[model samples]
Target: MGGFTLDDILATRKPRDSWWTVFMVDPLACRLALLVANHTSITPNALTRLSMLIGFASAAAFTEGMLVAGAVLFYLSFTVDCMDGKIARLKGTGTPFGLWLDYVGDRVRVVCCAFGWGFGEYTRTGDTDVVLAAVGVVVLDLFRYINGPQLKRVKDATRALLETRLEGQYVLAESVLRSRPRSELEQAAAEFEQTAEDTGATVVDLQKAFHARFPWYDRFRVFLVRHRVRTHVVSGIEFHAAVFVVAPLFGAAALVPVAAVAGTLLLTFEMFLVYRVWLASRQVPRTAAEREKILV
Candidate 1:
């Protein structure tokens, strides 16, 4: 019997996926992963390591100016990359180390591919500009990827602090007024406070509390996610394939710089959007008490 059904593979997808990934690459990769699922002994981390190994091979091929070979290997590496998560979700074997490996492996792949492009172009035409473009690709892409998650971390921490501090004020009020309050409204408040004190919330819970408080923030997040199609092409494996595979088919290493420049510009715009969303999230009132009356 097959370890994964079609629905099981589909269930591993992110809520907001790029059109190319959703329609093209992911479906094919998931099907392949499902076929291989009967093997049972292969783990997600093993797939991750395998993907990284193939990624290094892709980089070496690019460095040798074997564009078509590099491109094919790049796509294969990416397909394997997608497989790791699919396998993890299929087997319920996702781990913190698996996630860490996936994230770090992605960064390593970017660095290797970037340098490969520079080295390949240098071997072809000896242009110093190729090196500069590689640097820009790494800088802009890393900035966009790293900053988005870090900003979200900041927002989570700030929201948690606000929830705790504001609730502390309420607790202090209840402690000081123990002798004076016996009305029906006060009894309800006391009960609610007791319940809140008993059930402590995590950072994620506080973020959800804020999400409930601000409908627009939730809507805006959805909007950003849905509108990411424009930046999707020059990201991930697609970027490498465009430069390494398609460029050589046309006999033009010039496409290397072109992709690097386009990726930089796309990521710059994405960074701006990320910053705007983070700013908007920060503008929301953090305290649930303050946000209770108005739906932001």
Candidate 2:
């Protein structure tokens, strides 16, 4: 599309971590978005706002029991969502406010969509369980917002400690949040690094003590939050694809429940894993020799 090569389109991607995004949805959508960008006056933030509107329309369709229509709208929103990031990177117009707006917009969309599903299901079957499931979906999503920063704090601290040990200096840098801005993230990281430094604690020494105090916490947290398991468990392209594309083939009845069940199962598993990790973390420390052997 336009004169944009695949490599050129890919270069517009902000973060290339999510497997679904990298391998499936984003490339084609981003290519199209880039072409549109070249030919039109549409801006990245404009696409973001458009996606939000599409998301709300998707919810309205779901509320009317038009499952296929809702799904289609959701996909369009998601594609536009992808486009906004590509456009942002392409134009270098990204701002903290835009990122914040995107984050809020996503959460609001999900909640509204869930509510619409529940209300539609209620109209269809009068089953209150589905409504509760909708609530569960909202809770599950909100938990991520609440817990995410703390989890990131732990991860950043661990990373800084490890990198400091390995390299003898600490670098303050931002980790990308899908909907949050890099500039804000860098600001937070800078503050975190300064606090860590001011404590007069060597990053490595503190990390070793922290690890010794909470043995399995780091391992499980890393595995659950940052790896393949996380990608599959947390919805992105997969959830939307399943809801809009696959579920309609079965029936509209499966739409909300499928999303709810998937999210609940993953959230439940994470909760259980956290508890297990916490229990393991409370264990007494191993000796220095044991620690050395384990580290090696």
Candidate 3:
């Protein structure tokens, strides 16, 4: 299990590149990580555990008001965080357990960082708000974890619907074009045209009807309504990193509170995106047989 290489995961047909993977800069670093994994006996899980340890050390440094030390540790931990998954892929050790461990490690890292921020504040000004904000961050982090499975199901369902609809439409059109007799072909073409027209009209009518009957339904369209905002919010995580980088320039303890607020808000928005995706998925149709199989 742990001895497997990235080629094995690739054999499972996972996409080499995805939005999240691109955001993490995995593609650029994959080759280097692969080389390192191939020559080393270090397991991906060990890397994950090492990252957690580094994160803990970083938090401890922050709590002690050792800003420079804490920042360095945080960045190092982040590097380890990035390396673990790449190593897993490169080594073909990317098991379900390894994935689960990596995810759990990330959540723990965030929580530890939040707590470290609170500790830093306590060491400087004894403020309770920092601790409260840390707790809030953890709560939002849990929200994301809870919504994960639902979001996956929703995405899968949406992909299935689009594929099925496109395939069905193509087959119907081709069948009409390849009909045996001229009259039969003409008749088939007529039926096809009617279907095309009816589908178009039905979609337009449904959109109008839906808007008129449920004006609020537009809010449920995840990509249209929420994607940009979510992207912006998630991108703010880099801002937190920037703050840590420049902490020494701003000696004022007030900056810690500001960073805490920003972190909490970002985490909350991420959870909101997950929830919205899950809700949108609930609106998608499932197979009739599957539906019939439901006990309810």
The lDDT per prediction is 0.64, 0.63, 0.56
As a whole number from 0 to 100, the lDDT of residue 267 in candidate 2 is 68
Which rank order by TM-score, best down to worst?
1, 2, 3
- Using TM-score, give the best candidate's number: 1
Q: In model 1, what lDDT does residue 101 have?
A: 96
Candidate 2 differs from the real structure by a C-alpha RMSD in angstroms, to one decimal, of 10.3
Q: How many backbone clashes does candidate 1 have?
A: 0
Best by lDDT: 1
Sequence-dependent TM-score of model 3: 0.57
Task: Name the lDDT value of residue 216 in candidate 2.
Answer: 64
Q: Where is model 2 poorest over a 10-residue stretch in terms of lDDT?
A: 172-181
- Candidate 2 backbone collisions, by pair: none
Of the two candidates 1 and 2, the one with more favorable TM-score, higher being better, is 1
Q: Can you give the lDDT of residue 248 in candidate 3?
A: 26
Model 1: residues with Cα > 4 Å off, grouped in runs:
1-3, 161-251, 286-296
Q: For candidate 3, lDDT tens digit of each residue in 174-235?
A: 23433233324446666666887745321101123233455564444333222222233343
Score every model by TM-score: 0.68, 0.66, 0.57
| Per-residue lDDT of candidate 1, residues 1-296 (tens digit) | 45567788877776545545665578788887887686566889999999999989988987887767777787778888888888888788778899999988988987897789676778788888777777776776687577668767765555545555556333322232323322233555556567777554211222333344554654444444554333234454455445545555555456555666567656665665565445545643555665553323
